[model samples]
Target: MRSVPRSAEFRNGGISFWFRELGCPERRAALLDTVDYDVCIVGGGYTGLWTAYYLQRADPGLRIALLESEFCGFGASGRNGGWLSAEFAGSRERYAQLHSKGAAIALQRALMNSVDEVIDTAGDEGIDADIVKGGMRLVATNPAQRSRLHAEVGYRQEWGFWPEDLHLLEHTDASRLHVDGTIAAAHSPHAARVQPAKLAVGLANVVEGLGVHLFEGSAVTEIRPGDGNARPAAVTEHGVVRADHVIRATEGYPVHPRGQGQEWQPARSSMIVTEPLTDDMWRHIGWEGREVLGDAAHAFVYAQRTADGRIAIGGSDAPFRTGPARDDNGATEPQTIAELWRGLARLFPIAAEVPIVHAWSGAVGVARDRCPSVDLDRDTGLGWAGGYAGSGVTAANLAGRTLRDLVLGHGTELTRLPWVGHQARAWRREPWRRIGPQLVNGLYRTADRRESRRVTRTSRFAGLAARMAGREPHEPGPGGNAPGSPDRPGAIGEASGAAGPE
Candidate 1:
């Protein structure tokens, strides 16, 4: 559905996030006031649209409908950091412990391959996603961070051999990239970057092109089972449509009222974009207009350069909130901007002086274990998928296809992957979910300080250095599919045999 474009005079307000450029909106989509469809989706963001797109393509005659609350591109999908990185964000060791090795590998393989899937989609849709393909680089901030990287390398090897894509960049070269005195940095060609908003809009365009029914300004308030061959119907504020199957693709909005344990916590992560850099600044920083970069700093700042030439740096700094929150997520703390500026100065002094041109923040439904969840409701034949922490660009692409396959009653290697239904332990109702993020946020701050004080590695192979750090100490717990029983929702994965021991 078309929305009146937000005026250019509008300011960034309390937030400071800026995303890739996407053009004009169209007239609002007409509501499906009547008739029955095979399936109904609630949410017009990337995950919802992508699921509808593939599902319709896979089964053409199957009538499908997607309803968006506002105009498309109004959520995190259009307001993200625009990093299309392929390297999984969750620790590799955790992956080994969470899923069966084979299933983990398959899941990782699908996620890794989905990088190309985005590129292909952009190409097929004739959308310029501003994809830069050189790779993504992970810079280490302290000595302990080195161990984590080495451990990840070993664990990655343990699971399956990846290409020799990981490059161990040391000192002088590291400093050249603004990461001076860093212990070590890992570079992988497998990762890529792109313009986010244009991609989301392009996805919406493709969904419409496929002749699928996508309604904007339609927020589904309820889903009730229908009679006979017609499935349950999705009712919205404006109108309603009867359908056979309903897919609750709402990530931020957890509409499962009675299912307290089936909740997904919402988190508010923010970003800031600098004014276009001076030409001299770019030559020295030498990302060479390629690759997104993040350091092993416990704070985990991820930065990428935009096609229009601004630098977008994003980090988690606000209290986590549940449901679709754009403004109420909290404001940008002055201290955070100060800390981020210091970080930028540490790497690129010249770029630090550039005035910040834009800033904004959005919420993501992040699970405690830092992985997305794909759960199903057998009684209603309803499927759910969300909780992607922050790596949703590529993960959502793969998840959408996987979600589609699962909804269509097909089995996939992705279905058996460790992450699908394996959510962390539940928070007892309210106040806890709100308080828990601050707790985790505190841990992250402490961890960052801890990492900074650790020693730096001197050589690529200091003979014994890599060996000690690379040692595979112990196997992580419950890494693969638990075959015996379907777990009860809200139970910890470990207790349910869906994850490693607590």
Candidate 2:
């Protein structure tokens, strides 16, 4: 049997470095008494909190209650890589197929606006999240990666992104941005670096201050829809929360309501953070721009320069659990931690000496179509949004706004976004659900290793793997994963749970 790696010497549960520095929020009282409200939100992450935030803003008199199994930011929202990016979690082609190409473009624009919306709201609401809009810097170290970056740029321009919005840089130019061994790079101003935990906690505080009742440590056990003249209710071990409308906002965590679990495949992503780097170390690694960084590998890696000078990096290196159960405490496998360290060293040779200070992991939801969705059943008064497929930061904010519009019965632009009302097919049950994703993960790992060994412009091995991984080759452009628009099909975490949440 393989021994777990020693790199897991630090904190391994889902408590992120950001949370370690920002400090988690104190647990609030559980729901011991039955209560009634205008709306009841189950989940205290960004989706739930943001929904409460906007709902209160839209109608101050509306009573909103948020329920959490743990303290706010205790799940993926607090442990995610701090990238507020416009990268949609699903294929653009899928969105176009559901709606229209114009609709897809509108969704992209809305996501971009959501990034700014988050930054602006944090400032206006006194939620200091160390927000830095340095944009995203995607680097390619191999020939295939270089070609893929170029293709992505062309697609973006064709999809209405200005040439300036997606600019490609040569190795010489890109090397100035701290990423070494880059053959090509691309920069998009539609992304930002943030302290995720700070943002989640700040939002929780903001919502609570807005008269939204937030009940932590209250694990919701069931959701019962009301019939005529009755209100929907969420049952907990403590009591039942009855409201006119019940919204399911628990992404990554288990959804208590029946039928909801069929739609989401929970996958865990692992992460590690290095001890504070010295000025000399930073000088050697000239990433002063602080743009959130990612590589062009099939097993993609994402990183951010923390406000405290630490390099926190993460990837989907762990196996998905057998059931809906999650690694709630943030602990990750020792091998996952080790691989992340190796990736960091490879990306920045100067960081080989940087000791790791913290390690953690978190789960993210994957819809059957690998896209985020928002919907409300007017008949049952039940609304839900999640399955972000690792891009949940800004997506959650957009989902919150969408839920608000849906609940208020407004046919606004937010409600018409391509993701709204899109019904993804449910994942296969049992061993198939568990085994299928594992096979894809194994194929991806094999392909990444084989491609590096061959050093070829394109890897047939990775292509075959992608096909087996359930992604169609015909996916479109704009986004790298667009169906049939293959400049670089491997640019995304195509494997079900191959990377960190947004």
Candidate 3:
């Protein structure tokens, strides 16, 4: 039997191991007085940072301001699993329903390209976030999972993904990774490993260097739309930022202006990073390629090999908090840490003895439908981009570019993407909001448990849970399962936004 390390054995909550490795960035001064700019972006996470980056690049003369409640990269931006994979954030069928199947395919293709876009931008900006485009591995350890894996690969092919984009690994090729109990695997070239905090910090610097006003510790209390000749404004504790366009880029930690908190539910994901593994441990693991790893299960895990020789993995074992409350200090529960550690051991037993150096938690915004959206209202000069679930790393970049197009009123292809202007219904209120995630996640956990016991087909419990969440059981969506399932194929085993382990 695997040994469970005592909670006291590991350090928890210094934000994350990534932040501790690089050290927290010096906090910028907060917005102390009213300011006016062409664009004011609320939130300093990737969505806001990317939006600022793209808008500044598009028009260097346009004055922009970015407001953050804490230091930049303090949220999920700094705490994500660091898989910059081209995972679609929402259901393709849903997107197709809004536009056309062709548009949905275009969105997938665009996201695939976004993986490279981020890498290229990082290179151009000289931001080294330990990126390795070695690709992603989705492993299936059981018969039920293996069946879904095959269906996922088939779905991708049917959706017109190139062989180089996605393909099933031969048994010999699958053996190369040496992950325990891997019956089958799928490979996608569009994923990359990154140090998420580094990227967030570096991008913040890049935008600041471009003359965008970045006000750290500036909490936006409310975002008020413009009226008559007035411009939209972001009201903060210290001051107000009035701008022609006010972009809400708060992602998982949204502070809705009108108490419409149910628009996006804040979900939490926890992670654990082991101390640097020894060379012998690496040999036993055989993850020389350093591909981002995931498993095909209802409740899944994502992992990456750090440049400093540690394994950082995360998942959504405990996915939500009641109401809109979230843990800002990155504290993770003991059971979550233990569960994540056990998952790591299950995948790579050789590292089971490695001490866990750090464990932390972060939030991701999940829309009711589990899809992401980028919307802009020209008349009110109000705009927003987020709800990436757990695929925000790359999706944020696309959102930033799309936001730029919308703000500039450019009839670009990005403006035509189906997710642009898409708005998911608000989540159910009250006890349901609190109980819904826990209940669904519990069902998923149960389904995963049953699947582990040699179940031959996808568990009905999973489908039932999906249905309860208002997702089609058999349609391809962000978190859907089954062949041509409602969930997006490439992200089947991916961590949800808060639980993003990539």
TM-score against truth, every candidate: 0.80, 0.93, 0.94
lDDT of each: 0.58, 0.75, 0.80
Candidate 1 structure quality by residue, lDDT tens digits, 1-502: 2221122443353322333244446636757576677877777777888888899889888888888876666666766667675545333455667766676677667766887887887787798778877676766655666655555454455544374745566565555465555666766666666666677777888888887888887877776654455456677766887766677776654555233364455555666667778778777776774777766544456677777677767666533233334454224555545555555655556776677655566656555454567765545656667766566677777778877877777888766766666656553455645554455444445445544654343222221221322223232111110000111100001110000000
Model 3 lDDT at residue 367? 77
Root mean square deviation (Cα) for candidate 1 = 8.9
How do the residues 1-502 of candidate 2 rate in per-residue lDDT, one tens digit apiece?
3222333445656377777787777889899999999999999988999999999999999999999988998888888888888776666778888788898888878888998999999999999998899888887777766666677677767554677777887657676677677777888888888888888898998999999998998999899887778788999998889998999998767664654546777777777888878999898787777888877766667888988898888877544333464565777777777778777876887877777878887778777677778999888888999887677888899999999999999899999888888888876665666665556555555555665666555566556555655565434111122112133443342221213635
Ranking by TM-score: 3, 2, 1
**Candidate 2 vs candidate 3: which has greater TM-score?**
3
- Lowest summed lDDT across 10 adjacent residues in model 1 is found at 493-502
| Candidates sorted by lDDT, best first | 3, 2, 1
Best by TM-score: 3
Off by over 4 Å in 1: 1-10, 13-20, 23-27, 30-34, 89-99, 160-165, 170-176, 180-183, 225-230, 257-262, 318-333, 375-378, 420-427, 450-502
**How far does residue 47 in candidate 1 sit from its true spot (Å)?**
0.9
Top-scoring candidate (lDDT): 3
RMSD of 2: 3.2
Q: Give candidate 2's total backbone clashes.
A: 13
After the best TM-score superposition of candidate 3, give how far the Cα of residue 385 lies from its true spot, in angstroms: 0.5
Could you give candidate 3's per-residue lDDT for residues 1-502 as a string of tens digits? 4555533557788788889899999999999998899999999988899899998999999999999999988898898899898776777767777799899889989989888999999999999999999899999989888888887777766554778888899998987688998989999988888999999999999999999999998989898988768888999888999999999998888878554446777777878898889998888778889899888877778899999899888887454343564665888887788778878988998888888888888888777776788988887889998877777888898999999998888988898988988888887765766677677777777777888886777777777666766666334222221122224333465552344742
